[model samples]
Target: MTPKKEQMTMKQMMSRRAVVRVPSGPASIETIDVPVVEPGPGELRVKIGAAAINPVDLGVAGGLFHQLALVDQPDYTGLGWDFAGTVEATGPGVELPGGTRVAGFIDGFDRDHGSHAEHLLVPAANVAVVPDGLDLVEAATVPLNATAAAQLVDLLGAPPNDARRLLVTGAAGAVGAYVAALAKDRSWQVTGMARAADEQFVRGLGVDFTTDLGQAWDAVADAGALQEDAFRAVREGGRFIGMQPAARLPEERGIAVEVVFARPDGALLARLLARVATGELPARVHAVAPLDEVACAYQAMAQGSIRGRIVLVP
Candidate 1:
C-alpha cells in the first residue's frame, strides 16, 4: 500500500510521530507510535498534510534546548513547530468543521508531541484557515517565521523620526524577508543585509539591499541571530531586536536589546496568510519529503546555508 493508504488504514487509537529520547542529534531521531489524542473543549485535531523543518526543530533534535534545560519531557521530546493540515475533528465550543484546511504552530520546547506527526491537537484559537492560493507545503513554512518577524517588528515599533534607517540582517532568510517587508509599514527605511547574490530578492520586498553590515543604523533587526555583531551596528540609544530568545544579548551603549518569542495568534496569522495568498508576502519551499524520510530531511537541513524550508508530508 502507498503511504497515504497506509495512513488511512492505521487504527484511530494511535498516531505516528518523530521524536527524540536522548536528543544526541539528527542521527538519534526516531519514528514511533503515539496515542491519538482527542481534542478537549475549544481544541481541534488536525490530520497533518505538511510540517516544515526549522532551526528550532534542529535544536530540539540535537539537544541544544535540552542542554539549556528548556525541555523536560521524561520519555521523549517532540519535533517540529509549524504545520498545515486539515481539521479532522473539533471539540465543543469550536466553530470550524471537519475537513477545513488550516495552518499554525505550537510554541515552547517542553512538549511530548508536536506537528511532525500524523495528527496534532491544537487550540482552535491558535490556527487560521489556509487561504485558496497557498498550498499546504508552503503554508507550513509561514507560521513560526512570519509570526516571529511580526513580533520582532512589534518590539522595534515605529521609528522615532523621519530619518528611520533600519538594518535587517539575513534579509534573504525566512524571518528576515518577512521583517524586511513588514517593517516598511512602520515608516522605517529598511535595508536588508544579505549576500550579493540576494540583491534581487531583497530588493523585491521593496527594501534596500546591502551585502555589508554597515554601522550606525537607527535600529537593527537581527533576524540572522548575529547577537553582538548585529548589536554593534545600531547607533547609540538605537533599538536592537533579535530572534534568539535563548541567547539574548545584553544591553550596552544605550542600545535597547529585545528578543522575540513567537506566540500563536490565529487572528494575526489570518492577516499574514492573506498577504501570502495575494503575493504581498513570499512562501518559500526548498523541498518536500515523506514523513518517513524525516531523519534524512533533518540531516540535509543541518548541513547549513539552505535558502528555503524543507517540508515533510504525511
Candidate 2:
C-alpha cells in the first residue's frame, strides 16, 4: 500500500528583499511581493529571524564578486551572507521538520538567494542547529566572523616546538577578536593590535597584550608598512595573521604574514556554536536593527570601528 503524504502549510508569501546588481550600487531594503521559493533537493526554506551585516556584504553590493558570479548566474544577485531562522519547509532528501531553528550563510558569490529577506533558501549542509540559551539574533552573527577566524588560525597551523606566539592585526574587530580568543584557548601567546582605548577589551579576550599599529611599527621601521608591524611582537618564525584583505604585508625577519578571507563551512560553524553555548567563546554584538533599517546598518559598518557585529532582525 502507498503511504499518505505529509501536509505542508502555505502562507501568504511576500519577502522584503535586498538586491544587488553588476553595476554595484548601494543596497537598500525594499518591500516587494516575492514568489515562495520551493526548496530543491538537499535544501531548506527558512523563515529568517535575523541576519548580520558584514563588511563583505557591502563589498558584494559594490560588485566585488560580480565576475565570479557571472560564470554561474547571469543576472543581478542578492546579498546577506549570515542568518538564523526556522525551517519552514523541507525539500527532497531533507530530514529536518518545519520548525527546527537553525543558522547558516549563503555563499555571497553563489547568486541564488541571500539572507536579507523574510524567507531564505539554503543548502542543508550549510546550516547548524542553534544551541540552547542562545538567541537566534546572536547566533546570526557567528557563521561568517567565527569561520573567518577559524580559517585564519587553521592557515597558521600548529605552533612549532610547542611554543606558540601569535600576532593578530585588527584584534579588536570582530574576526580578529575571535582569532585572539581561539588562539589563546589553543595555548598560543597572543599579542593583539588595537588602539589604546580597546586594550582592556582585547586583553579580556585572553590576549597577553595589546598595541596599536603605530606602537608596533615604531620599533620595526614599518617594514612592509602597517601589516609587517604585527611582526614586531611575534616571536621570530611565529605567524602574523591579518584581517584586512586589501592590505599587503611583507615577510621579514623570518616572520610569515598571511591574509584570511572567511568562507562558509556549516560543520565548523556547528562546532563554534556549541562552543558559544558552553561559554567557551563569546559572540559579541554591537547592535540589533530591524530588517527595514538595513541601510542604516550598512552605513554604520561603513563608518568603521564598531567593536562587534550589527544584526538585522527580520
Candidate 3:
C-alpha cells in the first residue's frame, strides 16, 4: 500500500514555491518544485496556510530591488515577507508542539525562499503563536507592517511639550494607520494626512484627519513615501521619519531624517498579535487568492490604490 501524505517524512516531500527568475514584472512569476527542508536546531517547519502580498513583494516581482542592486541570486529570487501557518515539525530546543498556529515574517530582500511556499523553515524565536480567534489570513497581515510602524514610532520618541503636533502621511496605509494610533500613546497631538475618501477610516483611529499636507508640524511620518514633498512639511529642527530605507531623503531646514527598516521579533509580535485579536490593532484583507493565482494577484496589486492586503492561500 502507498503511504499517505501524513505518513511521509520531510525528506520525502517536494514543495512548490513562487519565484522570479528575471523579475521583469508580475508576469515573470513562476512556481517551481523543490525538496522540502527540515528545520535545524531552534527552528520550526511551518505548513503555511496564508501569506500576504505586500508592496515589497510587488517590488520584488517587478524588479525594483534588482534595479537597486539589492538582489543577488543565481537561480531565482523568492518573493514574500509574512505568513501564518501551523507548526508541522520542530527541531531541537523548540518547545512548541506540532500544530501550534503561528505567524511571522522574514526580513531581507535577497533569499532563495520566503513565506510564499507550502513549507517554510524559520527560527522558533522569529514566530509568535496566533491567537485563538484570529484567522491565519488576518494574522498574516500583521507582522511586517506593524513591526515597521512600532519601530518608526520608537524613532519618533515622546513628543516634546513645546512640539507635540505630528502629521502621519498615508494615514490610510497599513504602516501609517498603526503609527497614527500608536503615536498617541506617546502624547503626540497626531494628525493623519490621507485622501478625502479615507477621512472616515483615518478619523476612526482617534486622530485629526486632513487631505492637505499642511506645513510646520512637529514631525512628519512619511508612510506614504512622499519623499521630498513629505519632508518639506516638517518644521525646522523637527523630525521626519520615512518608510524607504534604500532611498532616504536628505535632511534640510535642520529636520532630523530617519527611516524605518522592520526586523522580526517573536516576543514583540506576540504582544502585537494579542492586541490585534483584542481589536487594539487593525487587520485588513483586500482579497484572497490561491497559490496558483499569485501572478494575477500581483498584477492587481501593481495597479495600485489597494487599501488592504491580498492574501495567498496554499
Candidate 4:
C-alpha cells in the first residue's frame, strides 16, 4: 500500500551517541546531534526505544568502509541498525499505523549514521509493526538475520525440502540460531557448526546434529570447504548455507552453497513474530543494556565473548 507521511519544521540537530570508528580505533559513544528531519514522502520517524549492536557495529566502529559496504566503499559511518520502537510521525502519504510498536532493519549499512540514538527517521516501507507481547530487545535482533534466511529459503529457488542437511557456521550466534531453528521447524534436517564449547547449546536448539568446528577440520583437510562432505549429512541434493561462503563445492556432490547478504523484511519478520506468539520460535536472551552501554557492548563483541544479542535501550 502507498504510505502516508508526516511533516515537521524548525528542525535542530539531535545529539546521539554512536559506535564510531575513527582512523585510530573503536570510537566511544559521541553524542551527535543531527538536524531534526521530518519524514519525507514514503518516510517515517521512529522514536527508537532500542537498537541492537551487531557484528556490523564492530566493523563500522573500526572504519572498515569496504567491509561495511561489501566493497571498496564510499563514506565512513557510525555504528548500529536493528531497531525496535514506536512510530512518531510519517512523511507525505506515508501512513504508519500511527503510534504502532515496530521493529525494522536499520539502513546503517548505507555506511552512514544509524539507529544508535533516541530517535531515527527511516523509509516507511522498511518497517513492520512488532507483534504484541514480544520483547522489544528480541525485535532489535531479528531483522538482518531473519531477512537473509527467508531470502535463501523462499527466494533463492530452494524448496523447503531442499533446505534439509543445512550447515550453518556461527550457529550458536543470534542469526545462526534463528536459521537453525526455522529450518528445523520447516522439516529440514539441520546440522550446525560452532566452537566445541557451544556444541550442547546448538544441539539444544533442536538441530539434527552439531559439528564442533575444532574437531572437524583437523581430520577433514578440505574441512574448510565442507560442501562435498556436508551433503552426506543429509539426503541427496541437500543445500549448504553459509554467512561466509566456503570454497567451491564440487559439482559431483550436487551441493548448493548459498552465500547470503540479508536485509530486513517486514513480512518475514512478522512471520517470525507469529511463531513467537505460537511458541514455535525460541527467543534467546543475549544481552540487554541501555543505549549508554553500547560502548561496552562493542568492546565485548570485539573480544569475541558475547554469547547473544546486545540490545541498546533508549
Candidate 5:
C-alpha cells in the first residue's frame, strides 16, 4: 500500500512510535503516531529495534532537502535511514516468513516515515537477514554506507582486476573507512583524505596514504588551481569516490571522479549482510538510543562529530 493508508487488515497493530521533525526555524524531534503496516507485494514491515541516524536524517530534520523531497512538508518528516529490525510481517509472494531478523537500507517515506520509529515498513528491494551472530545495533550501520561505497566501486565503472590507486574522501568516517577497507580486500590501493587528526585512524583502515586534501588527494592549489602533482598521484584513469562535490574539476587530468549519493538496495544489502555473516566484513555500532533521542542523533550527524552508527531503539 502507499504511505497514505490509515489502517490495515491487521487490527492489532500498535500505532508505532516515531520521531517527527516540527519545522519552526530550527528542527527538533517529537513523538508521533504511525500505523502498523501490512506489507503489500514486495514489501516488508519491520518491527524496528535498532535504526541508525545518518546525514540524511539530519538534513531532513533541518529541512535541508525540502527541494529534493518528492513530498512537501518534509519538515514534518520522519528522520532515520539505516536500521536492523525483525520481520513482523511480509507481503504477498515472499520467500521468508515473519521473525526474520534483518538489516537494510531505507529511504524516508515521502519525507515522512523514516527509520526513527518503533516499527518501519520498508520496500522488499532493500532488505536482508542480519548476519548470524551479529549485534542488531551494529548491523544497522552497514547498509547506507555500503550503498555509497558500492555505488562507486560496483555500480559505477571501476576496473575490478587492476590494482588501481584511488582516493577516498571523508576516509575516517564510517562510509569512507568501510570503503577503504573494502578496497584493500579487492586489491585497490587506497589513499584516504581526512583532517590530520584522523590520519592514523584512516591509516588503520588499510589505507596506504592518509593526508589532508593537500597531501593525500592534493589540495590542488587551494582547490581552485590544478596541481600536476595531484593529478600524478591518482594516475590517469584512477578513480575518486567522494561524498562531497569536488571543489575543482578532475577532467583536466583524465581522472574519473564520481560523487556517490547513497541509495537503498535490498539485494546489495543482502550481499553485504552475507559478507558480515561470513566474517569477511565487520560492522560497528557507535551508539544506541531510544526513538526519542533521534533529534540528538541527527544533531550529532549535522555537526560532523560522530564516529559510527547511531541507533534509535524502539
Candidate 6:
C-alpha cells in the first residue's frame, strides 16, 4: 500500500529563512535569520530570486511610516515590496503548483515579512505569471512602479475624444516613465518634464514633447515657487499627473491635478505585466547586487540621480 502523505508539523513548516534588520534603517541594516514562513489559505510562499528597491524603502528604513504600524517593536522588520520568484509552496485551497514563476508587490510597510527576504508569503490573488521569455530579474522592477503608474492613469480617467494633453512631472523617474508610457498608449497627448540630458530618452518613450523643468514653470504659475515651469505647458483646462501626494502646484487656471498613490491591484497589475512582457514597457534596471549587500544598494539609491531601479538578487 502507498504511504499516506505526511502533514507538515509546525516546526517542519517553519524552516524557510529570511533576513532581518533592526529598525530597518540604511545605517542600521543587519542580516539575521528569520523563521521560514508558511502561506495561509489562498496564499503562496515564493522563493524569491530578485527584489527591487525604491525610495520608499529608504523612508521605511528611516522610520517614516512608523504610524502605519509596519515595524516590529521587539523584532526587526523586513524591508522590500517588489519581488519576482518561483512558488515553492502553497497553502490549503491554493491550486498553483510548486515551481510556477510569478511576481508581485507586498505592502512592505504593513507586513511583518517583506520581499527582500529569501522566502515570502504572498496572496495568490496578488501575483501575476511572468510573461514568457522575460527575465525574472528584469521582471522584478514592474510591480510597484507599474501599479502606481496605472493608478495614476486610471485616476486621470480616459483621454477625451480630442486627445487631451497631459504633462507628467519627473517623467524619467521609474513611476513617471511608466505613467508616460501608459498614457501614450491610451492616446493622451503626453508631455514630459525631464532633465535636459534625458530629453532623448524621454522622447524614446514616445513623449510628444520634452522640455527642461525650468522652461515649463511659467505654463502654470507666474509666481508660485513650488510649481515647476512644466505646469504652464499643459493646456489651461487639461490635466497634470503629479508623482507625489504633496506635489505642490498652482490651483489656478482650472488645470486638474491628480496625485498618484500606487496600491496593489491584481487586475491592473496583470495588465501591466502583459505590457512588460510584450516590450511595450521598460524595466530600467540600473544596478543589481546580492540581497546581503542591501546597505550598499540603499546607499547608491540615496546618492540620487540614478535613472533606473536597483535590484537585489537573493
The superposed Cα distance between candidate 2 and the true structure at residue 154, in angstroms, equals 2.2
What's the lDDT for residue 310 in model 4?
A: 73
Candidate 5: regions farther than 4 A off: 1-12, 17-27, 67-71, 155-163, 214-239, 244-253
Residue lDDT tens for model 5, 1-314: 65445445334566555544554212456777666767899888888878887665665556556645544753466666788888988888777778889888766446567777777777777788887788788788888877767665663343455535566666777677767677666566667767788877777776765564443332111111123444445554454444532333456456665455567777787887778767666576677777666556566666766677767787
> What's the lDDT for all of these models?
0.92, 0.72, 0.91, 0.63, 0.65, 0.73
lDDT of 6 by residue, 207-253 (tens): 85455443322122111123445566656565655555245566667
TM-scores of all models?
0.96, 0.81, 0.96, 0.77, 0.79, 0.82
Candidate 3 wrongly placed segments (more than 4 Å)? 1-12
In Å, residue 59's CA in model 2 sits off its true spot by: 1.7
The regions of model 2 sitting more than 4 angstroms off are: 1-11, 22-32, 64-75, 110-112, 213-259
Q: For residues 1-314, what per-residue lDDT tens digits would candidate 3 score against the true structure?
A: 34665556544598989999999999999988899878999999999999999999988998889888889999999989999999999999999999999999998998989888888999999999999999999999999998888888988899889999999999999888999998988899999999999999999999999999989999999998888888888899999888865378888889898888999999989988999999988999999999998899899989989898999998
Runs of candidate 4 with Cα error greater than 4 angstroms are 1-24, 67-76, 155-163, 213-238, 244-255
lDDT tens digits by residue: candidate 1, 1-314:
99887877676678899999999888999999988888999999999999999999999999998889899999999999999999999999999989999999999999999889999999999999999989899899999999999988888888878549999999999999999999998889999999988899999999999988899999999898888888888989888888765478888899888878899999999999999999999999999999999999999999988988999998
- Residue 127, model 3: lDDT of 97
Q: Deviation in angstroms for 130 in model 2?
A: 0.3
Ranking by lDDT: 1, 3, 6, 2, 5, 4
Model 2: per-residue Cα lDDT over 238-288, one tens digit each: 556665444647787676666666677889999999998887777878999
- Candidate 3 accuracy as lDDT: 0.91
* Candidate 6 lowest-lDDT run of ten: 216-225
Among all candidates shown, the one with the greatest lDDT: 1
Error of 4 at 42 (Å): 1.3
Question: Global lDDT for candidate 5?
Answer: 0.65
Candidate 2 accuracy as lDDT: 0.72
RMSD list, candidates in order: 3.1, 5.6, 1.9, 6.7, 5.9, 5.1
